[model samples]
Target: MSSTILPVSELTPSAAASEAEDSGGKHPFLVALGQRVRDIRARRGMSRKALALATDVSERHLANLEYGVGNASVLVLLQVAVALKCSLAELLGDPTTQSPEWLMIREMLENRDEATLRRAREAIGELLGSGSAKASARSRRGSRVALIGLRGAGKTTLGSMLAEDLGFPFVELSREIEKFAGCTISEIQGLYGQNAYRRYERRAIEEAIQIYPEAIIATPGGLVSDPASFNLLLGHCTTVWLRALPEDHMARVAAQGDMRPMAGNKEAMDDLKTILAGRAAFYSKAEFQLDTSRQPLQPTFLALREMVRNALQMDQTEHAE
Candidate 1:
């Protein structure tokens, strides 16, 4: 599906300026975090209202937070953090990582150094291909590759690639609902509002799972904004995070099409960062994180494949034992 881009004239002056002022801003991070929050919420099938009820925060505030607004106070932030079962530091962006193996591998991949990428791929391939390597039972038991990241993090693009390469069917949760309703997502939002859209999305996801249990599914970046649906997803599948920089997300989304998020909203970038600050805790819950910034399609795909292979093999070994 094509991305929607809003023109400069349509964007609120403040929103445009915010985008411009953010030098390597927090939009991408916020997008990822928001997605994670939404996914967790959706998999739980909890509505925004439900989250509000649990956190004692207003629905509008929740919406604003999800949209990447800057109104979230420390108190409100703590409430959300507690409700989501996470620590404050994690939600506030923990920068003191000791550099995990995956991060190093991802860095190597992002370097665009052919030798390093090839070696990484070969090493992964050999590890998986070894005779003593475990068989892939996770694939048989039905693993889910739910895409989590800010909008325009190539979740859809990478999802399609994953489904095709893995020989599984691909389903975009948002697109499925749009197709089912016979209307664009924006239209649905305008007509029924976020709650109603979630209702439709919930149905679409349930139906999709029943129809194709083992498939690659590309959920809307914001699906996790609603708790009920997010929980449902978590119960049904394994999730992966498509990590990227905020600027990258804005650029990609802008290039693809819809600028509505940035339009007429002067605080768009700041709002994005704020949202990410709240949601990072949730997204960090995912099983794997795939950093796609500056990483090409081929190596990223290979890395994902390797991750899936490892997961499957682990599952198989568990079953065998």
Candidate 2:
């Protein structure tokens, strides 16, 4: 087709004024062109699929063009115009001749009413001024993380691997807990019950934060069962849940000869499932999650490392802004 030209004389002063007002008193012909193409396709009652087949482009590609979310190559645009049975200028209602969405968006932005701008500013301030503002600020300063998961999820094994790879110190929270409690973990749990064991767990974490401050901490799996304690941990560090199916967890723990959960509980297997189900929601709340089930130890550790790296990068970017 010959190059399509939009006639300036065909446009009304009011329509021209509207376009100018919308486009910051300037021409946004490309954006206008995109909207016009979409309008033409819609007017013909042709679906994106029909246009795609006729133009030999994918339907998704055509939709992206219509939405103006992606740039259409020169050849693609020409093919589309031909399929629509219209010249390029006709398809793109020329601002010298048509109205466009970006022109409208720009107009809204630049010519925004006084009240609207005020509200927008207020919202921005509130979002950046809250307690999370400090957390976000710290997020930029560094990309240190601590991995917290259940016993059989390979805390010590994975912690050493992660620390070596990331060049950070690897500290086991359980070991710290044992020292703080001044008793073996089993002794604490047996004498004081789960509650007292958790107290010792909290104390160990507090001391670790104060001392190490920037190490990869491997916390006990049962941490989330205590919300108050876990929230405290979350505030001090970025938390990731290393997750696996209950059966996988059970197998790993059993392989270690620590069958406390399975010992004479008749409903031992059922109890395990119940505990896993109960903690499912809490685990799901983690900032990042990794499924370790059926994955080799090395690959699972690698996946966890990448996720931490990505999360740290995201935190840095957010904090910098």
User: Model 1 off-target regions past 4 Å?
Assistant: 1-141, 262-266
Number of the top-ranking candidate, with lDDT as the measure: 2
Score candidate 2 by lDDT: 0.68
How high is the lDDT of residue 123 in model 1?
55
Put down candidate 1 lDDT per residue, 1-321, tens digits, no spaces.
Answer: 111221212223355346535734536445434444554455455677777889998877776665455546789878877886544554454442122464355555764865565455435534654211113313333655677777877888888988988888888888899987889898999997988788889898788767876778888877778766765565556678888777777778878887866775657777777776777766765668888886787888888888876875666567667
Instruction: Go through the candidates in order and give the C-alpha RMSD of each one to the true structure.
Output: 19.9, 19.1
TM-scores across all candidates? 0.55, 0.55
Positional deviation of residue 238's Cα in model 2 after best superposition, in angstroms: 1.8
lDDT of each: 0.66, 0.68
